[model samples]
Target: MLPQELDGVTLLVDVPLAGLQAGDVGTIVAITRADDGRLRYTIEIERPEGGTADGQLIDLDASQFGLD
Candidate 1:
């Protein structure tokens, strides 16, 4: 199923993500239907080591992620 807003998910594909892996967990911050009618998600990836909330936000297609 597609992830909803504020849902926790994991990356299923390798991206340009730093300090994170393909299976790294992230939170869905926002969702938007693209011009092609595909649902895109804005995810925030926190440091795996743990520290602050400082992390990178990335936009990915629903197929690139899996529900956590």
Candidate 2:
């Protein structure tokens, strides 16, 4: 079972960018439960060049960051 109070919380993280590129700051927009009973999150990474990248969050634990 999952918690009942993670619907609209903000997630802040500094994730690395693939393909040897520099990373950017990201924010979590949404969180939902998948069909397989796993949690999924939608993240938006904002770059310094006035662009952003959309990414997915898989197997992420909020408690690891003391958010629980």
Candidate 3:
């Protein structure tokens, strides 16, 4: 299900992997809706230590996160 504000929504990661915990927060940078009715989001996961050195831009399905 899509969030009320769509793009730029803050999300809480629901699944843990690759050193990321379940509650990691990310900010959506872009959104795409496919012709087949699938939604994809681009999010920026900033390093908690406050630097861009290890930050990541990840693309995830809508189910990957929850609105914060």
Candidate 4:
């Protein structure tokens, strides 16, 4: 399992949240388990060029991301 605040890259297209594409670098803000007891992540991706002002925080399952 990944640790909190670890940096990583997205591995899936999270269309609902700012259209996060594959390879977008992000940081794991928090780690929590889903209703099914599966691990989930709250990732904060600082918008490139736009910086944190246009960044996004999204929740995703473990399979949707990887260590950077």
Candidate 5:
């Protein structure tokens, strides 16, 4: 079901991926609506040393994740 209210919101995401540390710069590449009507966000993380890593945001809820 869709969220009852749509409003301004912010979320704090913490990813515990291997070799991922703090201070990494990343940009959101795409935001797509899933089959179940949920939104999926794709982020590209740029390592300071010299490489880039891609990740996906999953299993998010509108209420809990502050997404509307």
Candidate 6:
């Protein structure tokens, strides 16, 4: 079983983004659970200073990001 409420948890992204390389940080916005227990995470990417990145909200696999 996994914690269903993870909206505020920070995410350490390891995927590429708009004008940014992998390893960009993001925040978890939503999550969906598959019947098989795999998680698809909705992440909101942001610029280093502030504001939303062009990448914005995207779905990521569990292997693609880390919890912060």
The residue-by-residue lDDT of candidate 4 on 1-68, one tens digit each, is 45566666655655545666776767888888889998888888756777543457888876777776
lDDT minimum window of 10 residues, candidate 5: 2-11
TM-score of each: 0.79, 0.42, 0.59, 0.71, 0.41, 0.58
TM-score for model 4?
0.71
lDDT for each residue of candidate 6 in 17-51, tens digit (9 for 90 to 100): 54444666767778897777888778777666765
Residues 1-68 of candidate 3 have per-residue lDDT tens digits of 46533344334554344555455667777777877788777777655686542356777777777776
lDDT for position 20 in model 6? 41
Candidate 4 least-lDDT 10 residues: 8-17
Model 3's alpha-carbon lDDT is 0.62
Residue 9 alpha-carbon offset, candidate 6, angstroms: 7.4
Task: Say what the RMSD of model 5 is.
Answer: 7.3
The better-scoring model by TM-score among 1 and 5 is 1
Error of 2 at 59 (Å): 11
Q: What would the C-alpha RMSD of candidate 3 be, to one decimal place?
A: 3.8
Q: What is the C-alpha RMSD of each candidate to the true structure, in Å?
A: 2.6, 6.2, 3.8, 2.7, 7.3, 3.8
The runs of at least 3 residues in candidate 1 whose Cα sits more than 4 Å from the true structure, single-residue gaps closed, are 17-20, 50-54
Q: Which segments of model 2 are wrong by more than 4 Å?
A: 1-22, 52-68
Best model per TM-score: 1
Local error of candidate 1 at 22, Å?
0.6
Steric overlap count per candidate: 0, 0, 0, 0, 0, 0
Candidate 1 C-alpha lDDT tens digits along 5-65: 8898888988853544588778999998889998889999865687543467888998888
Q: Is candidate 1 or candidate 3 better by TM-score?
A: 1
What is the clash count of model 1?
0
What is the C-alpha lDDT profile of model 5 across 1-68, one tens digit per residue?
Answer: 33333232233444455344444334444556789888655445545466444342233343333332
TM-score of 3: 0.59
